[model samples]
Target chain A: MDKLKAIIESLLFASDAPLTIDKIKSILETEDRKTINNLLVSLTNEYDSQKRGFFLSEVAGGYQLRTRPEHRHWTRKIRLMKPARLSRPALETLAIIAYKQPVLRSDIEHLRGVDSGGTLHTLLARGIIRVLGRKDLPGRPVVYGTSKRFLELFDLRDLNSLPTLKDLQDLGQEWPNDSK
Target chain B: MKEQLKNKSESPYEVQLGETFEGPMDLLLHLVKKNEVDIYDIPVAMIMEQYMEYLKLMRIMNIDVAGNFLVMAATLAQIKSRMLLPVDEEQEEDEEDPRMELVRPLEEYLQIKYAAEDLAVRNRLDWDVFTRNVSEDTEACEKQDQEFVNISLFELIDAFQKIVKRVSSKHFMDITVDTISVNARISEVADLLEQHDSVSFQELLEGQDTKGQLIVTFLAILEMAKSQIIRIMQHVESGIIRIFNG
Candidate 1:
């Protein structure tokens, strides 16, 4: 049992990103998939019950050990060397630009319900987003898309890795209803 | 004094007739200021002559003036010459001020210049604040990196998906019940390697699919690796993985 636990820890630690049960099973000498799955469950429970600084999360279809949100500030400071605080407007603009990328300033304004020409310029200057191309319209307005730096900051491999709209909507429900 | 005036008239300025100023409006404005003339009542002939002189100097310096400058020069000269002609009552109706068209564009340019200066001042202030924030942010980032692993599981799935996509595109006979499962074959290979110190990876992969089989065998190698029953070694950029007993 101790050997199994040690093996699991080593495997998870050495893994470049994450590991799944099937992967552990295939790697282990044992032919029992159920045993590996049980082991993973038990490990996950132990980690969570202990309230460790790190937690095992099943994300992107694999299990990975990551720092808890409560420790994010300190951990980010220690690891990444800086925590840039984006303004509320900048964050909102970024979110819109990220999800609706290859979008135009006009489209962003329509969604934001505000004139975002200045915000777009700010984002462009910051290298957070860039002009993808000009639209085939009367004015030939430029279209914008998130830059590679966006993926680096978000820790995403590519745009395809973003959670689906349905997942976001479901997550949104977790917040308390503020209608008063 | 009349001869001196004639000599000045024959100078390079007059010699370069119809040559247009690079910045005709600026030159015209400058002339108006120097002569203390009203902008509304610009001395067209004097300004045109001065403008042509400037263009002549620019040409002598080998500077290629743009067509727009030349066009404006022509327009000014035409307006100046037209102003000299005595107009009858009927022809007076045909006359129009060319300077009237320039008024709006010039006013718009001035407004834009002022706005740009204001924006620059604001930007400088914002940049000072931003730099201070950046230093503080860097400290926070350093703390995060030290305490957090910051791993994303998505990267693993992406890697797996790539391998799957590569394997799927190639032609291979599907492993059926009658045929040995890759998992079982891997176990057998692991057991064999447990007794032998080393085995040829290519020899193990023999009798397998030309393309897809390599990946399957590689997967088997990884499986054996997980058990610590076998080990594989390879040089940088070498696709071959040498199998050995653990």
Candidate 2:
């Protein structure tokens, strides 16, 4: 058990990004998937129990050692990170991609009544939306869809968690001027 | 045009009165809803006049209406001209309404805009959620290494682990007698790097016979990257790592 803990600790510490149990298993040559996962969970619990400076976070489809948000004040002093704020146009483009996924670029442009090339580039760079494939149509335009990273970024459990238009309309019903 | 603009308050043309629109279609939708006009049965002539006035107002304010706005304007005019054509007494119902093309896409776009607005709300929420800064970004070096290949640190680690496993398996001897010091290994790697401005990971470890030599060489590479003497280049598409001397 100590051996397992030490190995996991070093691997997690050395990793530049979040890693999956599968990656660890392959490197450690351990066929026991469940054991590795359980070990990781226990490590996670141990970190929480001990009140460490950092905690294990399952994000972007893998496990990462993240500094505790409470300690962000101290971390922020060294971390001159940009506040990744998306413009209103980018958000609107993201919404279209999220709801009408597997949609063509032309479809997005037609809907927004404007070209969406720049906004799509921004979303792609951020790894929020990805090109799924080329649509089987004239010109074979590229089809796009939200990625797993998208769900992770939005704090959503899955695609099913995306708020529906009916939900938005329900919220709109409270507005004093919703005529129709 | 200026005459109608001055008498606009007398008409029922104040479409949503105070809303900002993202595009021409948005403005048109607001106009349709404000007057309680059916989208399917728009008063094309009246709506066309109302839209032009709105565009004029935008131009005065330097809002910079895009080309689509003018395109929609021409479309509305074309439809209005079709409306003016005398309806044939026979098979008149068979002829399609000119406004349907505009209405259908406008309706579809409006629904999408609603979804987009909802996502914008979620984007605002995401701002509150913080992520860790565990891995440092190589954005600064990325510009310099544009001529060099790009590779991720993960791929480098994966390759190192693979090579280490292969060498360890080739000889099961735990011989720790004459391992080169990490500092000495670093210097040797640096000399190899000085000869070649960029080298592949495999090239650096080539011809090393022992497991200890391979391991030391790998560690030296990692140490070099850590001390900023070199940058690990990962091919963006292939995930192959190369070393670029700083």
lDDT of 2 at B27: 64
Model 2 regions more than 4 Å off: A1-10, A40-55, A67-78, A125-127, A147-180, B1-21, B28-51, B60-64, B70-246
Worst 10 residues of 2 chain B by lDDT: B11-20
Question: Candidate 2 — which pairs collide?
Answer: B150-B234, B150-B235, B151-B233, B151-B234, B151-B235
Q: Write the per-residue lDDT of candidate 1 for residues A1-180, one digit (tens) a residue.
A: 868977987787667555767788788867887777777778788888999776665543456565665654444344434334343335446666777778988676544334556667766776668899998999898999988645434444456776644455444432211110
Error of 2 at A35 (Å): 2.8
lDDT tens digits by residue: candidate 2, A7-62: 98888887865678889999999899898888889989999999988777776567
Complex DockQ, candidate 2: 0.11
Interface RMSD of each: 19.6, 11.1
Query: What TM-score would candidate 1 get against the native?
Result: 0.29
